[model samples]
Target: MPSSTQVQLVRRPRGWPTEEDFRTVSVELGDLAPGQVRVRNEFLSVDPYMRGRMNDGPSYAPPYALGETMTGAAVGRVEESTSDELPVGALVLHGLGWRDVTQADASAFRRVEEIPGGPSSLHLGLFGMPGLTAYAGLTAVAGLREGERVFVSGAAGAVGTAAGQIARLLGARTVIGSAGSAEKVALLTSRYGYDVALNYKEAPIREQLRAAAPEGIDVFFDNVGGDHLEAALDVLNPNGRAAVCGSISAYNDSAPKPGPDNLSRIVTRTLTLRGFLVGQHPDLADEYREAVTRWFAAGELAYDETVVDGVENAVTAFLSMLRGGNTGKMVVRV
Candidate 1:
């Protein structure tokens, strides 16, 4: 029997998750049964939505069971296999994250095609769920149009980076981004294809947004809510659309935060503000993968990964990502 080390949730967090809330345990694995595969994870994703699962509340996904291994998205290689469909050495993407090794029904793992000159971990970032979220949110939810001006909050993070670049690729006249630090702001414009970038910490977001998109924005891809949402509401053009992909700003709040006071603008401007979970839009997956892969191959789309080595550091990476420590997708290399 092989032993695997896994991170388990020991406590539901009150606000920010602490190291004490998680525990690492080594467990012995039983012999693989028919239709089962064991994988050695190469990369594991740490995302903002995972924070919602850590709390004992109703969410789009079920809460993490206490004292069980935490699960997210992971890319790995099949180390042992008892199924013809999943042979040894096959690279696979699955939802068995936060662990160095995992064994499950072969049906739970999907084989990933290798991208030429690209790391397989891209499946967890650019060519995977986050990328799909960006595509669907912009095309379906926000109804982005050519020559439109767009704004994105949390613009240096995974989905934000993709959303901004996709907007430009789709013919947006101006793409504006907001980040927490000067470095991220620079990366937004210089690397992520944003026409304008603002450090939200430097000034009032409403003022910065107005200055960046002086003509008013046609689309707003909101990753951080609260003040960012309020600022977008103030500057959105009439009939502007907002794709509310996340509310990471309030993810760690212990108490209920006030709703955006400027929400009245939605009624007056006839704006469309809609929240979405990527899981609800799986119908767009094929189209998203094709477009993003084509853009990546053509050198028109770029992505970044902030990797923390080792499963022992997965919790640390997750907490750091929640605090805006990562410029792009934050992942753990196991």
Candidate 2:
């Protein structure tokens, strides 16, 4: 038997989650079953979606129970295996969440054989769910076309960073992004090849987005809803498309506030607004990997990871990311 450290939700948070909300404990793990494998968790993913899971409510994803280990995506090295399909020492990715060690049925884990080199955390970001979200949201939902202008809100995040670069690869004439910090803004413009980048924290978000896309936006990759969505709506060209990826701005609020005062603009501008979930377009994952891998290998694309070491700081990392503390994909090295 092996002892594993796991984090569980102590209580449902009222507003922003704090350290007190999570309780870490050591649990004893029994022997693996015939179809199971034991893994020593190496890296845990702390993402924006986990915040919604902490609450006791119905959502697109199921909420975490009060006493159960907090759910998250993680990558680990297999230490013991009872299944013939999985060999010991194989690195696999699974939804094992915040635990330092976990045992799973072989069916629940996916072997990461294609992605090479170290820092397999890229599997959680560029080559994983977030990457697929970036791809599907841009091409399928937003209906992006060559020579069109694209603007992304929350443009320095895991999905946002990928979105801008992917848009450029798809032959977009101009790519603009709005980020929370000056550093993130700089990364968007210089590192990610966004034609224009603005710091929404320094000035009015709508004004900066307006300045960036003066010609009016053809495709708006919306991540932060509320005012940003309204701003995007105001400048949307006729027949423009909007891919609603996330509404992080409103997530912390206990009550739904008046959001995006530009609802009427949707009608007049004839904008096409569609909400998206990455899981809805699972088939796009292969396409995303093929494209991004080529771009990365050719030095045409780049990515950054904001890693917070230890499971103890997972709550801190999550809150920091929501407060725009991260430049790229935020992960936990446990």
Candidate 3:
């Protein structure tokens, strides 16, 4: 028998979640049943979407039921298995995260190619969901074209960093991004290849965006909503497109905030704003992964990760990531 240390939500968070809202529990695992596999996770992913799951409310995905182990994305190896489909020592990716070990029917896990001595955590960030989100947003949703001017809000996190670089690679004439800090602002320009990086905290995002793109933006990749969305709406050129991936700005808000003040621009300028989930766009995953692989192998793509050691620190990583403490993907090294 083996035991797995798992984090469970004891209570629904009121606004900003505290460590008290969760409890770490140790559970004994029985012998593997037929068709089952046990995985010792190498990394646990902490993402912005996890915040929405903490509350019992309507969301794209069902809310996390109280008392169950918190679930997201994790990559690891099959330590033991009864299913021939997943043999021991095989690398796998699954949704049973927040736990150092996971046991489930083999069907719940997806096989990913092994990167020898590579950080398995990359599956949770670049070349995975975050990268796919940027791809679908820019191509399928925003219809980005060559020489178009592009803007990305919250351009420091996993998806943001990917979005900025992808926009440039896709032939955008100018790539502009806004971040919450000076350091992130530097990363956007120096590493992520953004032509203009604005510190949103130092000035109004709409003012900064206007100044950066005096010619108006052709595409908007929005991760932060509220003022960021309003700012995009203010400067989007006619027939511009926006991929509304998230609204981290209002993730913890106790009440619904008002809609973007300049939403009328959508009608007046024929701008397109589409909200999407990466899971809903599997049609693009294969294409995204292929491009990422090629770009990375050719030394054309760049990424970063903020790693917090230990499974016990998963909650800390999640909270810190929500507060913009990480430059890229935030993962717990299990």
Candidate 4:
């Protein structure tokens, strides 16, 4: 028998989650069943959507059960296996994260393909859920067109970074982005493909957005809601489309948060606003993977990860991501 340490949610967070809300527990793993596999996680993902899961209400995904181990995406190597599908030393991707070790039915894991020079941890970032979200939101939800001027809010985060680049690849004439910090604003242009970057903390977003895309924007990829949504609505060109992804701005609010005050513009400008969940659009998964694979191979795309070492620090890494402390994808190295 072996033991593994896992982070369990002991309390449902009210506003912001704290370390006290979680408890680390060591559990003994009895012998595996005939179809079971054991894995040692190499990396685990911490995402903005997890905040919604902390609540006690229903959403696309069920809330994290109190006193149960938290789950997310993880990449790891199978150490022991009783099934032919997964052998010892094979790399895999699974949804049993927030733990250093996992033992489950072999069917619960999927083998990760070798990417030649690319890091395997990317299975938790660029080539995984975040990347798929960006592609589906932009192309399918927003109906982004060629030569369109685009705006992306929260453009320094994982999905934002990918959305900006994907928009450029899809023939966006100009891509503008907004971030909370100066460093992230700089990275939007230097690293990501954004043509113009605005520091939302330094200026009124409406004023900055107007100046950045003076001609008006054709598409908006919204990650931050609240004022960002209102600002985009104010400046969107007639017939503009917006893909409403995550509203990270109000994720931590304990009470009901106000929405964009300028939503009337949607009717006046004949704008199209659509909210989406990646799970709802699995039809685009193969297309997204193929396009992103080509982009990565040709050096047309790049990704970043702000990694926190150790599974004990997963909670801190998650909190840091919520506060915009990470420039790109935030992951915990286990």
Against the unseen true structure, what C-alpha lDDT does each candidate score? 0.93, 0.87, 0.92, 0.93
Model with the higher lDDT, candidate 2 or 3: 3
Model 3 stretches with alpha carbons more than 4 Å out? 116-118
lDDT of 2 by residue, 219-253 (tens): 99988998888888888999999999998987788
Q: What does candidate 1's lDDT look like per residue over 1-334, in tens digits?
A: 7989999999999988899999999989999999999999999999999999999888879999999999999999999999999999999999999999999999999999998768888999999999999999999999899999999999999999999999999999999999999899889989999989999999999888977777999999999999999999999999999999999999989999989898789999999999998988989999888898789999998889999999999999999999999988999999
What does candidate 3 score in Cα RMSD to the true structure? 1.1
Please state every model's RMSD to the true fold in angstroms: 0.8, 1.2, 1.1, 0.9
Give model 2's TM-score versus the native structure: 0.97
Instruction: Please tell me which model should have the higher lDDT, number 2 or number 4.
Output: 4
TM-scores for all predictions: 0.99, 0.97, 0.98, 0.98
Model 3 lDDT per residue over 1-334, tens place: 7999999999999989999999999999999989999999999899999999998879888999899898999999999999999999998999999999999999999999965334778898887899899999999889999999999999999999999999999999999999999999999999999999999999998899998899999999999999999999999999999899999999999988888777778899998889999888998888888898888888888889999999898999999999999998999999
The better candidate by TM-score, 1 or 2, is 1
Off by over 4 Å in 1: none
Higher lDDT: candidate 3 or 4? Answer: 4
TM-score of 1: 0.99
Model 2: how far residue 244 lies from native, Å: 0.4
* Each candidate structure's count of clashing pairs: 0, 1, 0, 0
Task: Write candidate 4's Cα lDDT for 1-334 as tens digits.
Answer: 8988899999999999999999999989988899999999999999999999999998999999999999999999999999889999999999999999999999999998977667788888889999999999999999999999999999999999999999999999999999999899989999999999999999899889988888999999999998899899999999999999989989999888777788899999999999999999989988988998999999999889998999999999999999999978899999
Candidate 4 deviant stretches above 4 angstroms: none
Q: Which 10-residue span in candidate 3 carries the lowest summed lDDT?
A: 114-123
